[model samples]
Target: MILVGAVVVLLCWLLGFWLLWHIPAPGEFRRRAGRAPAALAVPESIPLSVSVVIPARNEERNLPCLLQSLAEQTRKPDEVIVVDDHSEDATAAVAARLGARVVRAPDLPSGWMGKPWACWVGANAATGSLLVFLDADTTLSPEGLENLVAEYRVQGGMLSVQPYHVTLRAYEQVAAGLNITLMMGMNVFTPLGDRLAPSGAFGPCVVCSRADYFATGGHKAVRSAILEDSFLGRVFA
Candidate 1:
C-alpha cells in the first residue's frame, strides 16, 4: 500500500512539473511590436472604402483610448459607427464627442449575445466596402487600419489580427496568457484558408469585406451563437 501511494504522489508531481514547464511566460510572446508606417496608402485604382464599427457596453473608461487610436489612424475610415449596447454609462457621449456616429441599440434579442447583437446593429448602419469590428476596450495603433486594409484588399476575404492584449491585474494576466495559447494552438492563424474547419477570432479586431459579410448572412444568421466570431468564420468558409 505504501509503495502504491508513493508512486501516485510521484506521478502527480511529474504531471504538475510538465504543466508548469510548458506554460509560456508572458515575456515569451513578442509584445514589443513596432507601429506600422502611418501613411500606408492603398492603390488608387481599388478605392476601398472602410467603415469602422465599435461596440461599447459600459466602456466609458476605455472609450477614450480607442477613439484617440481611431483618430490617429493613417488611413481614415470613411465612416465610424459606435453602437452603444444598452450601456448605462456615458459611452454614447464619449463616442459622439470623438465624431463617431452613435447608434443606440435596442434591448438585446432573446437569442442573441451582447457583442454580436451590437455588431449587427453597426453593420446594418455601415456603408463601406470594408467593415471593421473593433471592441471598446481595444486601442489601435496609428497605422493599424492601413495595414489591415492592405492585407484585406490583397487577400480579399476575412482577416483578423492578434492584438497585444494588455492587462493590469494578476487574474487578467493569466487569462490573457491562456487566451493566447488557445488561439495559437487552435489553428486560428488561417481561419478561412486551406483548412475548411471552423475557428474563431478574438473579436477585438475582426476585418472583413462588406460583400463577404452579407454573403455569409452576416451576424443575423449567427444570432443564436454565443461565440459569433467562430460562427461567422465558418459561414464565410
Candidate 2:
C-alpha cells in the first residue's frame, strides 16, 4: 500500500512539473510571431481580407468577451461567421447582436463531431482570402489579426498559435501548462520556422489561406476525426 501510494504521488508530481515547463513556449511563439502586442503598424492600403469563424454551442457566457475582443482588433476581419451548433441558449442571438453573421448548424453529419462540423459549416459560408478558426472562449489582443496575417504572409502556409487560457481551477492551469509543454518538447515550431511541412498545431487559433484551405480540401477531409485540427495540419503538411 505504501509503495503504491508513493508511486502515484511521484507520477502526479512529474506530470505537474512537465506541464508547467511547457507553458511558456506558446507565449514565446506568440511574442516572436508578433501576436502578443496591442499595437502594430497594420497597412491600411493593403488590408488582408480575413474571415473569422467561431464555433459556438451553449456558449452564451463566453461569447460576449470574444465578440468584444474581435470588434477591437487592429486589423479587423472582413467578416465574422459564428456557427451555432445546436445551442439551447442565446448563442445565436448574442452572436447576431455582436454584428456577426450567425449560421445555424444542421444535423450533426454521421461521422463528424460537434466542433469540427460547426467549423466546416462556417467555412463554407465564409468569403475571404483568409480563414481563421477561432474558439468561442478565446480573447485576442488588438494586434492579434495583424500578427496572424504577418505570420501567414511570411510562411506562405498555415499559421496556428497557442492562446493564453484563463483558468479558474488549478487543474485547468495544469492541463494548459502540460499541453503547452508537450508541444514544446516535441519542437513544434522549429520545423514550422524552416518551412518544413506544418504538423498538428492547436485548433484554437488556426489560420489558413483560403486557397490552401480549398486545396487541402478544408474540414471536409477531417470531418470524422476527433482530432480534426491535428488531422488538418497533417494534410496541410
Candidate 3:
C-alpha cells in the first residue's frame, strides 16, 4: 500500500509539472514599452480613425475615471460612444458630461444578453476604421490606446488586453485563483497562447478593425452568448 501511494504521488507531481510547463508567461507577449513618438510619426499620412465604444449598465461611478483616463491617451480616439443599457443610474448623464456620445440601448430583445446588445448598438453608431470596446470600470494608461493601435497594426487581427487588476478589498484577493485558472485554462500561458484556440479575450478591453468586426457580425453574432467576448475572439480568429 505504501509503494502504491508513492507511485500515485509521483504521477500527480508529474502531471502538475506538465501543466505548468505548457502555460505561457505574460511577459512573452511583449506588451510593455510603447513606441516612441518619432517612430510613430509618418509623413502626412492620414492616421487611422479609432472610435471607442463603452457599454454601461449602472456604471455611473466607474465612467468618470475611465473617461478621464481615455482623455489623457497619447493617441486619442476620434470618437467615444457610450451605450447606456437601461441603467436606472446616471450612466448616460455621466457619459454626456464627459463629452462622450451617448446611445440609449434599446430594450433587450428575445434571446439576447444585455452586454452584447449594448455593444452592437455602440458599434453601429461608431464611425472609425478601428473600434475599441472597453468596459466602464477599466482605466487606461496615457499610452494605452497608442500601444493598442500599434499592436493591432502589426498583428492585423483582434487584440485583447488583460488589464492589471488593482485590488483594495481583502475579498478581491480571493479572485486570484479564478484569474489564474482563467489564464491557464485559456492557454494564455501556453506556447501557442491565443493562436492555439482563439478561445479567450479579455472582456475589459478588446480592439479590432471596424471592417473585421462587422465582417464577423460584430456582437450580433454572439447576441445571446454569456461569454460573448470569448465567442467574438473565436469569430475574429
TM-score of every prediction relative to native: 0.77, 0.77, 0.84
Clashing pairs in 3: 23-189, 24-189, 24-190
Q: Which candidate gets the maximum lDDT versus the true structure?
A: 3
Q: Sort the predicted structures by TM-score, highest score first.
A: 3, 2, 1
Model 3 worst lDDT window (10 residues): 35-44
Candidate 3 per-residue lDDT over residues 17-53, each given as its tens digit: 5445554333333342244433332222536899999
lDDT of 2 by residue, 40-75 (tens): 334334457899999999999999999999999998
Report lDDT per candidate: 0.75, 0.79, 0.82
Superposed Cα deviation of residue 32, candidate 2 (Å): 10
| Best candidate, TM-score | 3
Instruction: Give the per-residue lDDT of model 1 (tens digit) for 1-237.
Output: 999999999997775454333332332212211224332233447778999999889988988999888889999889999999988889899889989999999998898888888999999899998999998888888988887787665445677665786778777777776665546443423323234353665567888878888878778888888877767766765
Better of 2 and 3 by lDDT: 3
Clashes of 1: 0
Per-residue lDDT value at 80 in model 2: 92
The per-residue C-alpha lDDT of model 2 at residue 196 equals 46
